[model samples]
Target: MQVRALARGVRMSPQKARLVVDAIRGRAAVEALAFLDTSPKAASEVVAKILRSALANAANNFSLNTDGMVVVTATADKGPTLPRRFRPRARGQAGVIEKKTTHITVVVSNDIEPTRRGYKRKPA
Candidate 1:
């Protein structure tokens, strides 16, 4: 079973968010949360919240074992830029500033064995 959570319009660049997400990919829920808690990057906190949400979703919706779940995929994408204007140096001159935004997604899934079909085992 799998569950996903998203954090949209986060006030961080997608590139920075991607770095944090990469660190936690394939890590178990508890370990990932721990790592995020101590991480020095600002983006870590945002990603951690989304991860926690995903864990809660799994537990509440799927009733899955939290300990057995790992971060299957985590990604960050660029969101709409917020435009701002500012005056710098010369009079009557204006500069445009673009505040970046990011959309982060985290997926948590439990380990499950794949089933094989059309085969029967013989009794010993």
Candidate 2:
């Protein structure tokens, strides 16, 4: 069975969060947690928390065996942008500042086998 957890309006940009999420995709839940623990990226902390929540959901809500769970899908999608703010610019001008947000979703499953897809190289 598959279990999923979502965190919306995260204060980080989707691009930044995607880097961390992509690394943990198709990895074992426990291993992904370990990777997040030592990761230096700021987004890792938030992703880790969401991963833990997914694991908990699997174990508690679905009564699944989390020991064999794999991270089936992990994604960070763009969220609603907050109101634009103006920052003082040169010559009394104002610069528009956009506050971006992200929505993160993590899915874990105990029955699916994880596979790693390698990058394809083109001939020179």
Candidate 3:
């Protein structure tokens, strides 16, 4: 089973969020949480919350074992930009500033297949 969590319009830029997400992909739930905890980036806190939410969704909604689940995929997308204008002291020169936002999605999965045994012909 798979569970997804999303955070929209986060203050961080998509580029920054993507760097944090790249570090935790394909990692176990506990390990990912730990990585996020020690990460120096501000976006890690937001991503951590989303990860925890995803884990809870997987456990509560899908009734999946949390230990077997992993962060299968994580993505950060650009959101709406806030534009602002500021004037400098040079002959009434104005500059445009853009405050970017990001949308992050995390998916956790617990659907590993069990390996088959070769010597299983004893008796029914």
Candidate 4:
């Protein structure tokens, strides 16, 4: 079974978060958490926070085993942008300062029973 959790309105750009999410895709949940812990990117912390939430959802809601779960899917989507601020420039000109946000979602799955291509096998 698969379980997912979403963290919306994260105060970071989607492009930045995507880089962090890529490292953890298709990896075990525990290992992913460890990588996030030592990663130096700015987005690593935010990705770690969301991954933890997803892990909690998998455990508490679906009764999945934490040790057996894998990160099936992780995505960082562009979210709503706040009003752009302006910085004063030469000759009374103003520069646009855009602040981007991201929405992150992670899905974890544990194969309680082995099946071919996620399909249920019928007895012969």
Best by lDDT: 2
Cα misplacement distance, residue 99 of candidate 3 (Å): 0.9
Q: Per-prediction RMSD in angstroms?
A: 7.2, 5.9, 7.2, 4.5
TM-score of each: 0.82, 0.87, 0.83, 0.82
The TM-score measured for candidate 2 stands at 0.87
Candidate of highest TM-score:
2
Per-model lDDT:
0.82, 0.88, 0.83, 0.82
Task: State the displacement of the C-alpha of residue 91, model 2, in Å, after optimal TM-score superposition.
Answer: 7.2
Put down candidate 2 lDDT per residue, 1-124, tens digits, no spaces.
Answer: 7899999999999999999999999888888899999999999999999999999998888778889888888999999998688999999999889999999999988777655641222234
Cα lDDT of model 3 overall? 0.83
lDDT of 3 by residue, 10-51 (tens): 988899999999888777778889899999999899999999
- Residue pairs that clash (backbone atoms under 3 angstroms), model 2: none
Better of 1 and 2 by TM-score: 2
List runs of model 3 lying over 4 Å from the truth. 87-92, 112-124
- Point out the worst 10-residue segment of candidate 3 by lDDT: 113-122
Q: How many residue pairs of model 2 clash at the backbone?
A: 0
Model 1 Cα displacement at 8 (Å)? 1.0
Q: Write out the backbone clash pairs for model 3.
A: none
lDDT of 4 by residue, 1-124 (tens): 7888888999999999999998888777888899999999999998888889988988888777788777778899999988788999999999888889999998877753223223232244
